[model samples]
Target chain A: MITIVAKSIVKEGKLETFKALAQEMVEKSRKEKGCITYQLYQDIHNDHVMTFIEEWEDMESVEAHQKTEHFEKNVPKMKALRHPSSEMTLYKKYI
Target chain B: MITIVAKSIVKEGKLETFKALAQEMVEKSRKEKGCITYQLYQDIHNDHVMTFIEEWEDMESVEAHQKTEHFEKNVPKMKALRHPSSEMTLYKKYI
Candidate 1:
């Protein structure tokens, strides 16, 4: 399985909207094939920082996820709510 | 529960040693009270980057963990293995 860690710093005053969008994405993504988990987290120390920790069966699953309607629609909206330097990295389980 | 996402870039040639140290930390940490999960992951796109996704029952549990012998001993070693600009963040689950 592969994991994706997508972290971003949400712009001030846009957290609620961003979160709503994220929740929609999560809810839809979780129903997709090969999706083991899809959850959103907000930094306790920095409320503006948010992350999505996701588990997928393979790279194909991840690619497919990006093509979904929810992804295609919401991701750009989410990005517009974030500051610069946001990052998303795919990881291979090591332990 | 609270989560912690610790990301770092391991120095060249230090991945193996870092993984070994991380494994030991994970084993010891999982046995600690309030620890739900403590796993290490390596970035697929950048082999030198690693991340730790952890869950704890509360902030106190996290504080207690920092005082553990295993944490004290290994975290420093792990830091030494990493390049500059590494970061550890505490998060509150929003979903």
Candidate 2:
């Protein structure tokens, strides 16, 4: 299994709208095949630092997720509402 | 439950030692009373990036963990081997 830790800092005043739009994306992402977990999290110390903690079967699954209609539709919207500090790290179980 | 995503960059050449030292801590942490998950992961794209994905019953359980013998003994060593970029984020489920 592969795990992905994604962090994106939202624009100064678009938190609510970003989350509202994410609601649908999250639901759809969770239902995708090979997706084990697709959940959103808000940083306890910083409200603007939102994260997506995700798990998938493998690289193939991850690519599949990126090509989905939900991701296609929401990513553009999300990108427009976020700063450039977004980053994602993929990891494999070590212990 | 609370989930924690902790990122720590191992010092230039101490990755192997850090992982070896973490072996015992990971075992002991998983055996803690309220720990649901206490596992490690190495970033696939960047070997220097390591992440600890944790789950605990609540804030009290989390506090208890930091005070445990294993954490106390190992953290200082780990800190000495890590860069200053280490940051930990606490998150509550938001799916």
Candidate 3:
């Protein structure tokens, strides 16, 4: 299994809207095949910061997730809704 | 090997403070033995959202980290300065 941790900085005043979107995204992602868990988190120190912990069965499933409509469509919307320069990382299971 | 994904929601109006903490934590963690990578991220849509992606050589290392002064001390401060809730998960590498 592998885990993907994603973090994004929202605009100065979009925390609420972002939270709603995150909640929705988490719900949808949880139903995907090979997804063990998908959770949305808000930083206790930053009102505009959010993160996600996503677990998948393997790389193929993760890659598939990228190709899904949920990702393709929402990514643009997510970008449009956020500040520029969001950070994302992918971790391969080496253990 | 293993990966730990941690998410925390800072109280409203504490983004900068939390970011600084996260930055310091990441820096300290990266230098530890068995740590492959430790990165801090802020959500693009929420300033209060913070996430961490930590890769370790094994569960033993991870457990050891928990006992480090860096963790034990900061954790309480982390808990006290926040909105009272944070989420953390450990992932075992199966791939």
What TM-score does chain A reach in every model? Answer: 0.97, 0.94, 0.87
- For every model shown, what is its TM-score relative to the native structure? 0.96, 0.95, 0.52
- Candidate 1, A21-77: lDDT as tens digits: 998998999999999999899898888999999999999999999999999999999
lDDT of 3 by residue, A1-93 (tens): 766777677887776777666776777788899998786655545556676768789888888888887788677777776877676656543
Models ranked on lDDT: 1, 2, 3
Cα lDDT tens digits, model 2, A1-94, are 9999988889999999899878888899889999999889887777888889899999999999999998999998998898997888999998
Tell me which residue pairs clash in candidate 2. none
- Candidate 3, CAPRI quality class derived from DockQ: incorrect
Global CA lDDT computed for model 2: 0.89
Give, for candidate 1 chain B, the lowest lDDT window spanning 10 residues. Answer: B83-92
Q: Look at candidate 2 and tell me the lDDT of residue A2.
A: 93
Q: What stretches of model 3 exceed 4 Å from their correct place? A: A1-95
Separate DockQ for every predicted complex: 0.88, 0.82, 0.05
Alpha-carbon runs more than 4 Å astray in model 1 = none
Better of 2 and 3 by DockQ: 2
**DockQ agreement of candidate 2 with the native complex:** 0.82
Sort all candidates by DockQ, best to worst. Answer: 1, 2, 3
